[model samples]
Target: MRNVVLFSFILLFVLLIFCANRTTKNESSSLQSLYHHAKVTSHPGYEHIWPNIEFGWEIIVGTLIGVFGASFGSVGGVGGGGIFVPMLILIIGFDAKSATAISKCMVTGAAISTVFFNLKLRHPTLDIPMIDYDLVLLNQPVIILGISIGVVLSVVFADWMITVLLIIIFIVTSVKAFIKGLDTWKKETIVKEEFVKHLESTATSSEDVEYKYLPSCPDDEPQKKINQGTILSNIQWKKFGLLCFVWIAVLLLQIAKNYTATCSIKYWLLTLLQIPVTVGVSMYQAIGLYQGKKITVSKQDHGTHWPLHLLIVSLSCALLAGILGGLLGVGSGFVMGPLFIEFGIAPQVASATATLGMTFTASISVAQYFLLNRFPVPYALYLTIVATIAAYIGQKIIDRLVNIFQRASLIIFVLSFTILVSAIALGGVGISHMIEKIQRNEYMGFEDLCY
Candidate 1:
């Protein structure tokens, strides 16, 4: 079965590449004369969708797509930006860059909703909040800094390059997530058997059982004297404050960067200022984790001190995730979701914590996009509200499902499936646009960030 699944993914990837190549060839042959000099309509980009607030078929269709994407994306911690960008372009009639900007808005909405839902919950077995505040502190600052770098780099890389890169990265990540889900599923099965046997032994033998191996069983354990207020009160306020500090510092620097000339001394200075704020916070957390002062409660207990290499590795993954967010116009949660699982964090905690961090970076991305005038206010607002509501609903349903099945692998599978769907959707749209440009004999090279 595993071999078959691997082969299936390989086949699907090959099929997408084949279609892209064939689509390019067919466009060349078919539209060579039909659209001489191509004169494709120069869409007024955001203005095309902005001024007209019509409740037409397109808006209706877009709302449906946004809701589904948000529901699943929120559950998977991917913020559905991968799905949102393509829907905005194909159905909603926004240009690619505009679609990317508005996609960030939807992601921000979903991430915010998911984070709110997660905050009210606790770790499956540990006496801590499900949202790992330490993990967020260690990763969020760098994720924000990485995003700053990616957003600028986004302009320099051509659209087709991003599309192709998105396809490759999403597919690879999807496969990894799926495989991790399978392993987690098997582990859950073993845990289930042990739990059942322990129950039976206690019923018949009456011998004192040590409960030595029931680590993952408390997933469905009912909360004791729990409410929204306590959930909020129990959070590590110091870490949360540091996270907000990095967020505000980066936001202010970005806002300042916009006022300066692109690539000017002041602009570069403002950009460089972001690094110290982010690095200082992450390094502080890393040192704490190393000296056993702070813990990634999702991955550690009170006495669990992390190795230096693992600390270095976490920082590296944080950097990669940050870069991925900037390149993909999505939250870094998509990467963190699976990475947390590999670090021995439960899938439930992984999804929650990743989304919490996503809330910060995605909202920041939305602010930056807005500052760039990349999205229409009306469209962004409407779609954001839609995503927000959908995310809340999704969280409720998924939480119930996890409790009922006692299988946390469900979230991992959702993460993988969403990324896979994004790969196909984004790849198709990108290839379609690339073909049209090829037929039009337009430039297909890197773009000027300053321009």
Candidate 2:
């Protein structure tokens, strides 16, 4: 029944794409003109809507691309935004800002949906914490700091800067994934009965089992609790208070900017009301943390003193990932996962924490992008829904096969190789585009690529 439902859902998506493509030639040029105008025209009352937006082959292809990217991403325990952004730029003819904005929205939606599933997941025979809230909160502050910086910088820079940075990020990540895949493949081998026993043990045992690809802390060691006297506990008030003030300030500025732009009174009013809703949620969490009700770190992990070096490295990586993620319109989950492993976190815990952090980063970045009117709002919601659903399906399939799949290394290798090839292709196109734009000494937008 589950398989049938999945197949039916996929078929519906395919049918829509096929029908949309079949009528591609019938897309009126006037509608195409409208799309181009809509992107650049800051007309106060004009909201880009259906019929005014170009709907044809590109969108269909883009949707399919998102599905494929998200499917592989979920299987590999990565976010799809990296692939989504590049493909949107190279194939769908979207500008860098637009691609990043839409990709961020998609990632945010997927992360939120996946988090929901992870939290609710229950096994009749197996008992475990599926979503590690403690680990997530531990990483949130630093990750949020990094993401905040990234979002500000993303909007501050020129589109070309983002494009160039994305090329570098893609190439580097591809190489890393390829190397990691080889290592993972070599370490995992299929032993049919052994695999079955392990799965059974996992279901029956309360003890943590360590797999080569997914390691756990020693079973003898008790899970650590946060030290009440730690700096994290003492400084929560300052931290949350500062964050609240900054976000509120930013919200006010956005409202002011909207008014100054002479946008419709409705636009500014809506922005004033809508922006606070998100900020309020963040502030609420911050308040909880400030009240010492949240555990942000473990005392045992720090011993008698703070692990300054660990803190520095983790935050630095997060900050760097944030910049890359914001510029590329991704959460950089693959990158963060390895960093978490290096920090000696369990694979399961790291995955959950990374999802939460990615969710926050993507949400904040997309919100900023939306304020700047960088997103294609009409298409964003639909595409995000599709990607989120696809991610959930892909995750479920991978979960069922996790214990049985012995050739994990081979799977990773193929996926990494494909990502590498795609990166190279995207890099080449980006470089060539940059060269042409530089030579012409002119600013060209996505409208130039309209068919």
| Candidate number with greatest lDDT | 1
Best model number under TM-score: 1
- For model 1, residues 1-451, the per-residue Cα lDDT tens digits are 3563355346534534553564455444342322222112222222433323344467667878887899899998888987898898888677676777788888888888888888777666666777888888988788888887887787788878988888888989999999999998898789878867877866654234433222223342333223123556657888888888888888888888777878788988998999899999999988998898877766764326878888888888988889878876767987888788788877777888889888888788688777666676766886787788788788877877776677878889999999998889889998998999999999999887765
TM-score of 2: 0.64
Q: For candidate 2, give the lDDT.
A: 0.55
Number of clashes in model 1? 0
Deviating ranges (above 4 Å) for candidate 1 = 1-51, 204-229, 301-303
Worst 10 residues of 1 by lDDT: 33-42
Clashing pairs in 1: none
In TM-score terms, candidate 1 sits at 0.84
Clashes per candidate (backbone, < 3 Å): 0, 1
| Candidate 2, 1-451: lDDT as tens digits | 3974577487656756654664574455463543443354233444432222344567667778887776666544456766787777766676655676787788777777666555553211123344444444444544554454464465556556766776676667667766766655555444445655887866655445434333122232322111012333232355435444544555455546445534456645644553344444444444454455543342225323334465455556765775565454456575675565445443344555577567665666667667777676766776787678777776565544543453434435434554554466556656777888889897644321111
